[model samples]
Target chain A: MNQPIAHASLAPATPFRTAADARRAIRSGAWTGHTVGLAPANVQGNLMILPADLAGDFLRFCQANPKPCPLLGVSEPGSRRLPALGLDLDLATDAPGYRVFEHGELTAEVPDLEAIWRDDFVTFVIGCSFSFEEALLAAGVPLRHVAEGRNVAMYTTAIPTTAAGPFHGPLVVSMRPMKAADAIRAIQITGRLPAVHGAPVHIGDPSLIGIADIAAPDFGDPVAILPDEMPVFWACGVTPQAVAMAAKPALCVTHAPGLMLITDLLNRDLAFV
Target chain B: MNQPIAHASLAPATPFRTAADARRAIRSGAWTGHTVGLAPANVQGNLMILPADLAGDFLRFCQANPKPCPLLGVSEPGSRRLPALGLDLDLATDAPGYRVFEHGELTAEVPDLEAIWRDDFVTFVIGCSFSFEEALLAAGVPLRHVAEGRNVAMYTTAIPTTAAGPFHGPLVVSMRPMKAADAIRAIQITGRLPAVHGAPVHIGDPSLIGIADIAAPDFGDPVAILPDEMPVFWACGVTPQAVAMAAKPALCVTHAPGLMLITDLLNRDLAFV
Candidate 1:
């Protein structure tokens, strides 16, 4: 059983105001946990590393399924740095925690990718929901899961991803219950930020998208939905991970859930409108 | 006992391509029916005419409740022309039909305001949902009522309007049943045209907004809501009329429902984004 390693002493005492500060702290081993509150003003990304041979199919998959796999930045094969995301970002070390997968199964969880960094590995930084979540909070839309300190309930939907080569699977969506008004507002707010999952894929009835159970999510803890609220679902970053695992890639690496790679891109800059 | 007088010979043989053309047809007695398909590319407005004594409060009410009463153009007291909407636009005779109200009660419906026009009457042209509906249809969002040749279903919600002087009443909303996905797309599409009601006020679970029965609408015709569809609601142009009626003004005039005042402004130009 590969469990995520947590370093108690590595947590930062103060939040980072800039992406560079957060990256430096992570690179120096001072911060080795989730990057949620570390850099409040920067974009955070879901990180995935695959072999050079599999990168093309994955890229095509992302193009075909933009809602689930919105590309933020991609690094050249074997490159440790992603200059577009951050000036001094180290792809191998900037992320707080990394998960190593072998033949679609979790093999090890480490603080950094230093031990098994592959020369043929290509780094893909995908957009995360944090940016839009921050926007939603700023707009006064409340998130029950965030308030309760629980992971957003995620479920595997029957909605199929546009297939590309061997990269294909059901789209996994993260659910947040909201009042009808707030849900409508959330749709508009997230619609402007297409880089971060854009708008919701489905709203209201769970059965419409093949989710047989609302209280039981396949991943993440289920938050109690109020009687006055309707469940709103967004295309999740987990889709690529789920699809990659299903493809049974020989070797794969991903940022652990909740732990992300902080980038220099401002969340506002990602809003196309 | 007065009712709208429709002249079969007054209906235009060919659809007008320009606002000027449509206004000319209406002005001349060549069009005396609904202005639904006339000047399809131009903006059409919900007409409201009130004496100078009530105009100020009505303006304030519109400002407070922009979703239901988006002001597109206004004419000064005693002025028959709204040059901003169109140089040739006549508030008195440009609309195909006008409804006269006295003490909040429907007194008479006429082809034009010529016989009842007063020097102190102030005309307010409000943005209509037709613009956003066209945009939605262009974007491939299907409208069931339009296909069935029936009026959009409307209801009076428990949502109260912000009162201004003597203007106050329950907020009236138009309901459109749509698949969750199409409803999401409608929100984004309408969000761009703020002048025309903007995004929907509520979505899913009509009872949450105090709509007890979705099938029995307070105004307009009710359409079938499919089992897989959710009822999406928007603040209706009928709201101002409802509010004004509740206020019981001495005299009020409005364009007959669906018989709008066509303007020179292109619908696309009204999109804020």
Candidate 2:
């Protein structure tokens, strides 16, 4: 099992009440760690920043693989503001941490994008599982990882993505073990929120999807599958990062794992129903 | 395995285009068989008629156990018309067949209630699984029983219904076997139609629900559960008949198994979502 990757900074003792407050704290260099429990009711998203020349192909890639890369908000070329997602949001400095990539490799981790900000960058905010997880938890669905305070277990699957341009790779999924009844209810609940990874991509036997070991995951920490529970798999937001890395663009940037961009949009609003 | 009870009449040569046409044929004595394929797009319901003295308790029982006995319409004591369910429906004669019960035992099966119709009898129309089954089939969820031309398997479960007065019995469930992905999709499809035995009551293991054998059902015909498929169970309209029999009402009437009351309400209109 992969242990959660530890970051340099520590999370603040008290969580911020609103997305603006949380983003303000992160912007002021007061909190530089993962935004796990911060602004609990707001939408927190994964970030993907690529040069304008490759933005159209990347947009097509996201449109094709919607389950893994549900586009929440997209910024204009060279723009720092995504007004639809957050009124006061600055695409460059709002996220707690950023991972800069060079030739498909992690080059450096920065607190903010001040030094690396480029005029040709286009920002894409993709929907994360946090939104649907909140809905599930609110509906009294027990989440083992949430109770254990660990990151969700994620794995690479034999399922292939509909390739667009150079962005082609195996689909990545996050797994949650649930009793059969809860799993059924989870499908109904998540099926309403197509904006947040939507419903699960696969359920039951992991081997059918080429997952050899339930105890081991390629990303995040693994949680035990209780005797009564079956592992439910959802398309992961990390797919964009993984695909970007494989594509080896000249310069690509993303929010570090668990270090997401908090948006003003209420999680409930994301549910179409 | 329980074989479906053989009725005296055969199904019509062709399905009726509308609920009105189907009910008209039944009322005029032109059709006296099962309504399975008739009025496919409309709602078909279970019938329960009891004395006015027992109607309140039966209504309460249905309200408490809505999943099994979803109330579609009710008639005033001795009134044969249920305008909301059908503009010209005559409750006493519109159904293809009726089962008359005396002291909890089936006394007779009759073509119509003309011989036993009483001034104090109240009619209760309960939603059936056929509506959700139609929705499921429309969504491309292949039902094994339908393909095999066998009745959907049904079992009496350890899961008990909430009692109201003397009305109480274990829940009766209808089973359909499907692959994990189809089962998940079926849950979502059925969850939308609460009026028609919405969603599944239980799934997976039959032993957990006190069902000792999957091959032998207490009601309906058995269909094979493929190795890749798990049995998905939904609350059956048969529960009201089971409860009514257990309660041992002095006099009770119900539609003969498979001979349901076709209603004017389209199955699509039943979806709350």
Residue ranges of candidate 1 with Cα displaced over 4 Å: A1-14, B1-14
lDDT computed for candidate 2:
0.85
Accuracy of chain B in candidate 1 (TM-score): 0.94
Interface RMSD of 1: 0.5
Model 2 chain A weakest 10-residue run by lDDT: A1-10
Spell out the clash pairs found in candidate 2. none
Q: What is candidate 1's DockQ?
A: 0.90
CA deviation > 4 Å runs, candidate 2: A1-14, B1-14
**Model 1 quality (TM-score):** 0.95
TM-score of 2: 0.94
Most accurate candidate by DockQ: 1
* Tens digit per residue, CA lDDT, model 1, B170-189: 88898889999999999999
Give the range where candidate 2 chain B is weakest over 10 consecutive residues by summed lDDT.
Answer: B1-10
Clashing pairs in 1: B10-B30
Q: Write the per-residue lDDT of candidate 1 for residues A51-153, one digit (tens) a residue.
A: 9999999999999999999999888999998898887889999988889889888988899999899898999999988889988988999988877777788
